[model samples]
Target: MGSVLKLYIQVAFAVKIVSCSITMVDNTTSKSPIDLSTAFLLRVDQSGQGDYKRIQEAIDAVPSNNSELFFIWIKPGIYREKVVVPVDKPFITLSGTEASDTVITWNDSGDIFESPTLTILATDFIARYLTIQNTHGNTGKAVALRVSGDKAAFYGCRITSYQDTLLDDAGRHYYSNCYIEGAVDFIFGNAASLYERCHLHSMAEESGAMMAQKRESPLENTAFIFLGGKITGVGSTFLGRAWGAYSRVVFALTYMSGVVKPEGWNDWGDSSKQRSVYYGEYKCSGPGANRSKRVTWSRSLTKDEAAPFLTKGMIGGRGWLRPSPTHFKKYQTS
Candidate 1:
């Protein structure tokens, strides 16, 4: 009898320990307002004992509303798959082993229907040192990365597609130290985006590349501002065409290649857009950057007028900006 009682006590103790551990884990993961710095690091290769080997699996494991920072450390490899970061998943950071070592790629075109390599609709997301690509070149509106998230940032990354490669669909996003390559409306969308210190490469094309389509609420004040960037194309390429009547874009201090046309804007088969579109350039240089006979509708913005659009407060707003290092570290391992 004494032995039996001792065995029962042991079983009860084990169950208690397991229950307590599960509760702790649940508390840690379910908390709202997650801190990204503390999130677990996921490695695609066998480098770490993460929850999963594939990027999509790791993303799936994260709770839809996890309020903790989650980091996916991707290994060096080319992952060809359609990845989507849905709206409910926030505070996710995807880091690569190295910019050149890790590549996430897929092939899909708008003509193909309902195919996108990566569709991002979550807020407060960051991707660094990786390449997101769509292999469908000249296939028609193939998107490499579609970002519709607020306060989303991509650094030291490469985004490649053909027609609509880098789709800044919605929100105030930032792309720095990155490379975006495409053909037609390559970098097009309705987002208030800031591309800084990046390269915009236009493939060989007859009509050239169209940069943006700002179709948003008139009061939303959406703008695409390129700072300290370069625009290069093979054939005759117009800087952009007006996709919506109130489409707004400003190219400041950019290096334009000779392939760009002087007019700097396309009609997109809509003459009414000519009246409502606002395309402007400031301090642009290069054979293609010539604005000598630019459309009368487009004007060059003064430095002062461009200041608000460049700042983080205006682009990202208040709540979307990631926490500072001090605050971020405190939240991690809490």
Candidate 2:
């Protein structure tokens, strides 16, 4: 009878393991099936303890247009280099244990498109628990991170710079539990993105704007939606300013400190844009969330109006947001 019980327990354990593997490898969250067993893992450690000493070296090893996933585990250290993931390399995950320990920093100011510290041009990329920053202090157009790829997601990351910090350029992106800091037009972009439970800190001394959305036309499906986050900063600032004719941005269920300006939205010195842009806020609390002095062009969204921005569905997250890999195999040099 004792042997019979032991055999039953062993069978149960085997079933549990199998079920967990199925969930990971079967791409349950994605519409398309991803055989995570094929995923490759690379490591970067400055202490001479990994596949490559530098992060870009490991990224260069990935084959162009490869279908397999590559997981680059970055060790705790500060990496000072300019990194770019070309469009050909997709399904790559840059993982670090903690954002405070593993950092990638560069100091470059000017040409926002050409001089970003890190540029992600690949699709289906993920960054987890890493700090990406540009220390071009109060300089002109210094972009810490520029993401132009489609279906990219950043989790537990810290992205910082001065002006034009994060260029959410062109794509459908998701930022969850991240800290973003900057002064003027820091979170500007034309991407259809969802910032969930993130912290946005403004470093402006006098006055600046948190976002400068650049949606050119009403027909374009691009907007910035912030959900369940907190906005705290040093000085007064506007929630957003219209950077395009039909710029759009929204904040819902967020806590805004007194740092936010009474007049929520700016028309970018273009009175013509007041009629085309779509800025809205819903169920937001705190002193800054008060819309008594908000621009007439902006909206205080109702429950029904805010429903669309409330879920991951706005960015089709369920179809592509694979938060974790099934497994990892150590890097092998060929």
Q: Let me know the TM-score candidate 1 reaches against the reference structure.
A: 0.83
The C-alpha stretches of model 1 lying farther than 4 A from their native spots are 1-33, 46-50, 111-113, 317-319, 323-334
RMSD of each: 9.7, 6.8
Estimated TM-score for each candidate: 0.83, 0.90
State the lDDT of candidate 2 residue by residue for 1-334, as single tens digits. 6743543343224222232221123322223335654456677889887779999998998878867788787888999999999999999988877899889999999998987988999999999889999998995899999999999999999999989999999989999999999999999889999999999999998889999999999789899999999999998899999999999898999999999999988998999999999999999999999999988899999999999989988789998887465444444544
Any residue pairs clashing in model 2, and if so which?
none
lDDT of 2: 0.86
Q: CA lDDT of each candidate?
A: 0.72, 0.86
Judged by whole-model lDDT over C-alpha atoms, candidate 1 comes out at 0.72
